[model samples]
Target: MTSRRSFLKTSAVLGTGLLMAPNLYARNKKYIGVQLYTVRDAMAKDPVGTLAKVAKVGFNTVEGATYTGTQKFYGMDPEQFKQVLDDNGLKMPSGHYMLGDGMPNAKGTIANEWQKAVDDAAAVGMKYMVCAYLLDGERGSLDHYKETAHKLDLAGDICKKAGIQLCYHNHDFEFKQENGKFPYEILLNSTDKDLVKMEMDIYWIYKAKQDPIALFNQNPGRFPLWHVKDMDKTPKQMFTEVGNGVIPFKDIFKHAKKAGLEYFFNEQDICPGDPFNSITQSYSYIKKNLV
Candidate 1:
């Protein structure tokens, strides 16, 4: 099994003689984005056609995903891939990077993987690099979080050099109480303010019984990116359309400046129905209620 911390070390062969070509970045305001994970099935089947639909749905920004066997983006070289995104009126906002040398016990770093990540991202004109999610064992303890923060500071430094920034995305676990205080607090307190930033996953905060307003009040200007997702109203805790959920995004967006929100993307871990319809509804909610 590959450790979430490793990406380059998997004895897994890159059988194709392929090197990604670089393409210029596209800049446009109408392109509110969607994380590709939302349309995994669609992308897997027809990346070009599916991306065209995403643009028609009114999203111009996009994040990427990686599966166990495939490490490349949508199977296109970075250049070809960027051209595809730009042709569809979209740009890569961020990408989920599998950290490390792709090997167990590889004496490399999670940061090293990120260095390459930023390079690839820069090649395609991305402005932010984020650690998408933390897995169980790979999540080193609170001390490990601090250690991760150190690495992020360095990564942020690298990003800054390339005209990009580094951010950490969260799940419900970061809100867990540690000795009566939330670990998220420690992560926020310990990381260098200028070097590290956050991409708030609003749905996860709600799952942890935390309020986005209160979070904004406590740490203003710390969050710049957001995963604007919603939860179901039913007892099952499923994902639903944005406005239908319990989160008060209207109230949250009111304080966007103070919260340091610069960019946001619509994401749903699981949609109850057609993924396209789900995103269309999500986009409508954001444009009307939040943005």
Candidate 2:
């Protein structure tokens, strides 16, 4: 029954199928991550249980939000925390840290005992440590921003020694014009590019009426991480599930390679109902639509 014509056609079809298989496998290989801040309450109550639930919901990575208060990851020391993450089959490649002023007396902050924090992060196998936020008291003038940029570079040097990258997470405030110049611009220009990279918060950039694409074009390969939270279409512009909001995530994700994006975390600062439900919804939408 093996005619030459039929066998040749069958071979061509099989070759086509084989060619398409690699693309499907590559698509499945993209990592999906979540910010633990989305489940703050549950983490506060029971971090291990919360992480288990997060893994059950199909998130392979998590970004930490709390550290300064206790100098620990989710109320556990670095070793214990890493074990919990391994137990749940999760990886934490990045975590948030406050600038020295936010909690002045904190032991493991960037300003106080930075070496210890960096060491702990290395112990946890983290590849990146982020300067989480700047308080109003901490940010005032361009001079202050320059000083902060210098500090970031210094912190970054410590991170570099540990084989970890240092990044800055931004809010809309950095875009505000102070002395006829954007502090964010100062931060980008003042720091050593290799030492201090950016964690572009897509939601906040949009909220500030800035274009993420433009930023990517301006500073190629400088943004190594992203906070992939979305904003609602309402006038209030509240946080919403990833695809449920108006952000063009598909378009944004298309430029991931150009932006040097290694990892991105879905974060919703506030949720309407159960936070786990919100995170699950976001994870589903992101997995279906964006990488």
Candidate 3:
């Protein structure tokens, strides 16, 4: 398999624009964003500088990944973070927030911190607050997933009241079967469609051997956000920059309308070098090919 860097070099030689013609325009002109988690280290060091680099790479929007514990976004207050984004010509329409340790009591009331998270998200002008992951203790049986779904609905209600939407971001584990049923299915069926939407990580969906288009067909308009990463062609299937791997993104982008895609972000969890380079390569490919 070609290394992502090498593939990018080769594509440049092939004349990227000429090779990737007939591109589909993005439904939302600012749909191309980068999930900041892709550069967590840099963000931790200097969020302002990192965001400037992100803007320089041609990203107009960003999805934040660091809003846990700090009660602030990337070590700054909500207003400060918003100003940083504005200075860099960027907007954050969505952000990842962990459903904290406490579960809803028997009365189905969530913790105060969760409500605070919703409030903070709204203050930052974010339209979506994504339940980014589920801990090991949070998963096991179908009933556990159903319970989580109930919590998601409660959280979604809070977010809806705050004028923000709540979404769930899935990993491959959600697709694993427990007692002949996928937890993903439980979450989808158990949650109220209007309250809880989904953010599809296309790479993980492929890793789980599932078809994104099939899911879109089954649950039309449920996925409004997507994490666009590619899997290396090798059996190990390591994460690679978009368009440098075997995943057929062009085919996937063709179904954006059916999937109700409002925003898509490039997110490579692990990169070979500077994360910005990985994002830039993905951005170039998306602009010239997938849109």
Better of 1 and 2 by lDDT: 2
- What order do candidates take by lDDT, descending? 2, 3, 1
Model 1 lDDT per residue over 13-127, tens place: 2211111211111122354789899999999899999999999998888888752224356877678889998898888877665444233442223434555556667888887
lDDT of 3 by residue, 1-291 (tens): 333233223322222222233232225855689999999999999889989999999999999987765677898888899999899889999998776644433111234477777777887899998988887877878897888889899989988999988899999998776665678877877888779889999999999887888776556667889999999999999999999998999999888876668898899999999888899999999999987
List model 2 lDDT by residue over 186-264, tens digit each. 7877888779889999999899887787676556667779999999999999999899888999998887765677889
> Best candidate per lDDT, number?
2
lDDT of each: 0.70, 0.84, 0.81
Candidate 1 segments whose C-alpha is farther than 4 A from its true place: 1-31, 67-71, 98-112
**TM-score of candidate 2 on Cα atoms, chains taken together:** 0.89
Position 66, candidate 1: lDDT: 58
Q: What TM-score, over all chains together, does every model reach?
A: 0.83, 0.89, 0.87
Q: Go through the candidates in order and give the C-alpha RMSD of each one to the true structure.
A: 11.1, 13.0, 10.0
The best candidate by TM-score is: 2
> How many residue pairs of model 3 clash at the backbone?
0
TM-score of 1: 0.83
